[model samples]
Target chain A: MSEQKVDTRLWSSKARNLSPYVPGEQPQHANLCKLNTNENPFPPSPKVGEAIANVLEQQAYDLRLYPAPESDDLRASLAELYNLDINEVFVGNGSDEVLALVFASFFLKERPVLAPDISYSFYPVYAQTFGVELVQIALEDDFSIDPDAYRQPCSGIIIANPNAPTGLLLSLADIRKLASEHSNSVIVIDEAYIDFACIDETNSSTQVSAVSLINEFDNILVTQTFSKSRSLAGLRVGMAFGNASLIEALTRMKNSFNSYPLDKLAQAGATASVLDNDYFEQTRQQVIDLRKSLTTQLTTLGYQVLPSHANFVFARPKDGNASAVAAKLREQGIIVRHFDKPRIQEYLRITVGTQAQHERLIDALTAMQTYSEDSETISNMG
Target chain B: MSEQKVDTRLWSSKARNLSPYVPGEQPQHANLCKLNTNENPFPPSPKVGEAIANVLEQQAYDLRLYPAPESDDLRASLAELYNLDINEVFVGNGSDEVLALVFASFFLKERPVLAPDISYSFYPVYAQTFGVELVQIALEDDFSIDPDAYRQPCSGIIIANPNAPTGLLLSLADIRKLASEHSNSVIVIDEAYIDFACIDETNSSTQVSAVSLINEFDNILVTQTFSKSRSLAGLRVGMAFGNASLIEALTRMKNSFNSYPLDKLAQAGATASVLDNDYFEQTRQQVIDLRKSLTTQLTTLGYQVLPSHANFVFARPKDGNASAVAAKLREQGIIVRHFDKPRIQEYLRITVGTQAQHERLIDALTAMQTYSEDSETISNMG
Candidate 1:
C-alpha cells in the first residue's frame, strides 16, 4: 500500500477499522469478454422498456414526484408471482441493499449470525458494517453447506443458494431441516440464482425456491434479485419474500433508512419483467443450457468442476493454479473471476457466457494443454 | 395497532424498538394540489429523457450489466460542476440514503451527533437505525439555529441548509464558524434546498452553500440531491462533496453496505440534469417567485409566515389550527404538510406550486376569513 495522508481521526471507529467488499472490476474494454460478474447473458424482457417509457410518457416525465414509498405496484406483482400477499413482499434498490437491511433488521443480537465461510463475501462485510458478530461455518468437503452445523443458538443464518465461489447447492430437504431446527432466528435463503436452479426442465411443475416455505416457516426470509434471473442488473431492483411480520421488520428498517430506495423507473421496469414469464423462462433456460455446456468443456479439460445449479461454474484447473489460469485468460481478452481466499484460491468461478464466448475460452485452454503435451513429447525425443 | 399473530422472536432488538420514518402521503386524487412533499412542480429537463433513452438505444437496453459500482460518470459530472476532485464526490440512491451512510460512517462515536431540534426528522431515525446517540439542540425563539449552542464535544453535526419545515437558512459565515469550531468532528451541511436559497435573483453569484467550506475544513461535508432543485425526485439520485479523505470513509461504508446503490437510469438522468443548467435555473426561479406570492397572500390573511429561502414557506394559520386547516384543504383536493410534533404543531409547510395553485389557496383562505368576519358582525348586532 502507498503511504497515505488520510487522517484516521476524522472517521468513526467503525469506518476506520472496517474492510470494505470490492465488487468485480467492470473493465470498459471494447469487445472485452466480461464474465467476472454473474450477470445474465440475456437482456431484460421487452416489456421492461415499454413499461419504463410508459412511466415517462403517461406521467409526462413525472420524475418530479417521489415513487411510492411502499413500492406498491412492484410488490403486488411479486406477491402475485410468488403466490403470497402483497405485504409479504419487500423491495429494495438491489438484493445487496435488501440483505444489508436484513443484517441490520434481524441479525443484531447478543448471539452471532451463522454463514458458510465460502459463501457470499458480502455477508461478512455486512456483519462488520452493522456491528453483528458473524460465525462462519466451514462447508463440508464437497463445498455443500452442512445443515447440522447450524444447529445452535444464533441470531440468524444466511446461506446463498448454489453458494458463490463453489456453486454447490444444498437440497431443499436440508434447508427445511435448518429452518425447523432454528425456528426462532432468521434463516435467510438468498436465492439470487434460483431461476437457473430449476428442478425440472419444464420449469413449470417445480422451482427450487425457499419461497415455498415462507408461510410454513415464519423465520425463513428469501432474498432474490432482478440482477441474475430477470437480467435487470443495471436497474437496481431486488426483493424479499417472507411472513408479513418479517417483511414488516425489513420495511420498517427501510423506511427509517431511505424511504424510496427503489426508483420510479426501477419499480415500473421490474413489474413488467415479473409479469413477462415467457421471456424470463426462455432466458433462464438459456443460461442453464450454457452452464451445462461450459461445465462439460471444463471437465474435458481435466478440471474438477463443481456440480453447479447456477449461471456460473466453480472449477479447479488441471494444474491447480487458478490465479495463473485466470491471468492467462485475461491476456486472451477473457475475464473470469478468481478469488485469492483460502480453500478457494485454486478455483475459478467462471460465468456461463454465450456459446461463442465460452468457445473462445475453451479453445485457449485446449491450446495450452496441447502445448504442454507437445513440450513433453519433444523432451522425450531429446 | 391490531391483534396480530406475528412471531416477535424472529426480529432483533433494533427492529422491535426503532421507530421508522413516515414520509408525506402521495394522494392519488385526480384534482389534487400536492404541495405536501416539497417536490418540484416542474418536470426535469428534456435532456434527461433524451439521455435516458440514449442508454437504452445506444447500449441496446443493456440493463443486463451492473451499474458502475464507483458511480463513475455521475460523480465525475458532479466533481466538474462543483470544482472538486472526483474522489471528493460520493453518490447514493438518494440524499436520504447518503445521509444514512453518513450517519453509519461518521457518527458512531461516544459523543452524540448534534442537530437543531425541529430540523429534518430523518436525522433521528438514522441515528436510531445506526445506534448513534443524537443530541438535538433546540432552535431559538425566532426558529433559527444558534451556532454558539453547538460549540461542544460531539462526534458529528448535520444541519439542513434552509432547514425543513421552517424554511429558514443560515449564513455561510455561520456554517464556516461551526466547521472551524468542530474541526475534530464531521460537520455535515445537507444542501437539499440550497438552489432555492439563492443569494441573488441571477443565481450566478454568491450562492448560499456550505460547499465553499469543503476545501477549507476537512470536516465539512456537503450533501445535495437532484430530487429538490433538479426535478428528479422519482429518479433517486443524490451526492455528497467533501475532502477526499472524508469522502473515502463514506465510500468505504457504502462499499460495505451496497456497492451499486444508484441505478443506471438515475446516473444518466442526473448527469443530464446537471449539464442542463438553464432549465434548472428557470424552474427554481419560478418556485422562488411562487413562494413570494404565496407568502404575501398568507400574510394578508393574518397568518404568520416565516421568511422562506426554500421552495416552501412555513406558516401558522390565523386560526392556529394546522390540522383543521389541512383537513379543510384536503376536502378541496389540496394537500399541505402539517407536523403534529412539539413546538411546530401549529405551522403548515406548504410547497410552492404553479401561480394558479397559490391563487386557489389564497381564494380558499379568503373565503374562510370572510365567513369569520360575518359571524363576528352578526353576533355583535344580536
Candidate 2:
C-alpha cells in the first residue's frame, strides 16, 4: 500500500487537541498486585460464570441473530433489582459509555454543563467532543463537592458520589438537594463507587453505600458499574436508573447510535451477577474492610490519609514527597496512581489490594522512609 | 422525590433537533421469519460459543479484573484476518458504533462528508449527531453509486458496499480511484455485506470488494462485521482496518471515551468466530445459493429484482405496491422491509433466509398474487 497524505482537516478541530483520559495501569506481570485501578479483589458471583457459559452453549444460531435491540430482559432484571419499572433503566457497554451517551443526548448543549474541577476526567472530554459549553466547579478545601456552588444557570449536573481520587462522598440529603435545585435539568449522580460507600448494616459499619439514595428523586439518574464491587471490570457492564421519560430518551439515542449496545455474554453475565445478591454483598464487605484497614495503616505511618468510601485510599506522606514514594513503590513492582496535577500532586491514590499486598506496601513505605531520613541527614551535614 | 424540570438547553443543539434513526422491526414473536432487519437466519459458529464458554469457565478472578484497556488479543486476530499489522486494527461494539466514532472523530469537520443519498439511512443521522456537514450525492437512475459524483472536494467518503436496502456493491477499482483522487481524505467502505457479495462470482462478475482495495491505499478504512456471515449479530462485534496512523487516531479517541470497548465474552467469541473459516464460508455460500434461487423465483413472478450481491435482494413487485406486498406477507408471518422514502419507495428488501424460509416466502408471494389479481379484477369491473 502506498502511503498517502493525511487530511488533518477532516478530523474535528478538537480531535487533534484532545488529551485523552488515561486509565489506571493494566500491568502484564501475573504476580503484580493490581492496585493501580480500584478493582475488587474478589471474584464475581459464581452464577455469573454459569449463566455466561449457559448462554454460550446455546445454539450458535442465536448469536447469528441480533440481540434484543433494547436489551429488554436485562433491563427488566435491572428494574427488578432497583425496585423500578423497566422504563427506569438504561444499560450500556459500561458506565463510561452510558455517561458518554447521557452527555451526548442530554448533558451537552445550551448552557455549560457543571462538574467538579477535580472529577472523572472523561466528563470534560465528553463536553469537548459534543461541543458543549463547560463549567467546572472547584471542590471544597476538603476535596468535597459544595452542592450550593452548583446553583448556577447551568444546563445539567454530574457529581461522582464518593468521587474518584479523593474517595469522598456526598450525603443522600446533599444529593437530593442538588437534584431539587436543578429541577429543570438532569442531575446525574455517578455512583460508580456507591457499592463500597453504602454499607450493609448487618455486616459492617464500613458498608455504607449511596445506592439506597436512588429512591430520593426522579431527575436523578443513578449510575452504577459492576467494575469495582462486583469484580466484573473486564466484563464491561454498567447501568443507569432514572425516570421513565429520561430512560426513554437515552434508549432512543442508543438505538440511533447502535441498536445492540450490550452483547449476549454481557447481558447474561451481568444479569446473573446482579441476581446473586449474596456474592455482591460479600465482595463489597471485603472491599470495605480492606479500605478501612488501609486508611488506618496509612495514618499510623504518618501519612495524611483521606477518609475514603471507595476501595482505594489517597494519602500524602508526612516527611517525604508523595510522588517520590509512589515512584519507589513502582520500582519494586507496586503500581499506584500518581497524578501530576496541582491539587492532588502531593497525594498518592493506591488501590486496596488483598491483605498480603497491603502489608508489602506498608513494608515498602517503611523502608523508603528510613532511606529518605538518612539521605536527608547526610545532605544537611555536608 | 421531587420532579425536576428538564433543562432542554443542556443537550447539544444538534442532538436536540436530531431525528434519531429508527431501526426496522425486531418483532417479539420467535416464530416470525425475521427478515426485516437483515439478521442472518443462521447461528454463529460453534467455536465462537466454545470460546465464550471458555472465558466464562476461567477462574472467576479474570472477570473480576479489568480487561486489557485495549482488546489487544482480539485486535491481533482481526489484524491477521485482514492481512494487516496489529496497529492497523480498531475494534468496537459493532460497526455502527465504530462508524459513529469515525464520523465524530474524523469525518465531522471536514468539508461535508459524502455518501449516496439513498444509501444506508444511518449515514445522515450520524452526520447530524456529530455536527458534521453532509453533502448527499444522488444515486444514478439504476440506484448505484457513481464514483464521478464524489469528484468534488470532500472531507471524507462513506459507502456501504452491497449497500443496505439495495445490496448493490461498488467495484474495487472504483473504490481505489476514489481513494487515489481524494488522497488527502479518508475513504470508508463499510463492507457489512462483503462476505455475501464475494460468495457469488457470477452475479457480481464485475464487482470487487473494497476490502481488496485497502491493499492499494493508506487513507482507505474497510469495516467488516461478524454480524452477517459469521452469524454473531447478537454478539455486537465489528472491526475497522486501515493505515497504522489512522487506526492510532481512532485508538486515541476510544481511550478518551471508553478504554474497554469490547467485553470479555465478545472478545473471545468474536475472535473464535472470525477464525472459524469453514463456518464463515459455508454460511456465506448458503446465503448466496438462497439469494440466487430467490432472485430467479422473484424474476419469474415478474418482480423487478436488483442485481444484489449482498445476502438480501431488493425487489419491487410487478403489479403490486411494495408496502402492500410487505403487509400482505406479514399477515402470513413473514416480514420484509419496505421503505417509504423517495428513490427507493417502490422497493422491498428481503433477507436471504434458509432454503425453507425462502420457499415459504415464494409460496406466500404466489398466494398473494392470486389475492391481488382477484381484487384487481373487481376494481377493473368497477
Query: DockQ winner among the candidates?
Result: 1
Per-residue CA lDDT of model 2 for B196-311, tens digit only, reads 88534655333466655566787898888878878888888888988766776777678766778888778888888778888787877778888889999999989999989888
Q: Residue by residue across A1-382, what tens digits does model 2's lDDT show?
A: 1225444444566567666777877888967766788888778888988887777666456777777777778888878876788877889988998988888777765677899999888898877766667799999999988889998987789888889889987887787788788877788889898778753434554523344555666577778898988889888988888876677667667766777888877888888888898878777788888888888898988999988878899898995387888888988989998888888999999988899999999999877776668886676678
Off by over 4 Å in 2: A1-10, A199-216, A370-382, B1-12, B199-207, B371-382
| lDDT (tens digit, per residue) of candidate 1 on A123-203 | 999999989999999998878887998888999899999788777777889999998898888999999888888556445
RMSD of each: 2.3, 4.2
TM-score of chain B of each: 0.96, 0.93
For the candidates in turn, chain A alone yields TM-scores of: 0.96, 0.92
* Each prediction's TM-score versus the true structure: 0.97, 0.92
lDDT of 1 at A212: 91
Model 2 per-residue lDDT at A382: 84
User: DockQ of all candidates, in order?
Assistant: 0.74, 0.51
Q: Could you give the CAPRI-style class of model 1?
A: medium
Candidate 2: global Cα-lDDT? 0.80
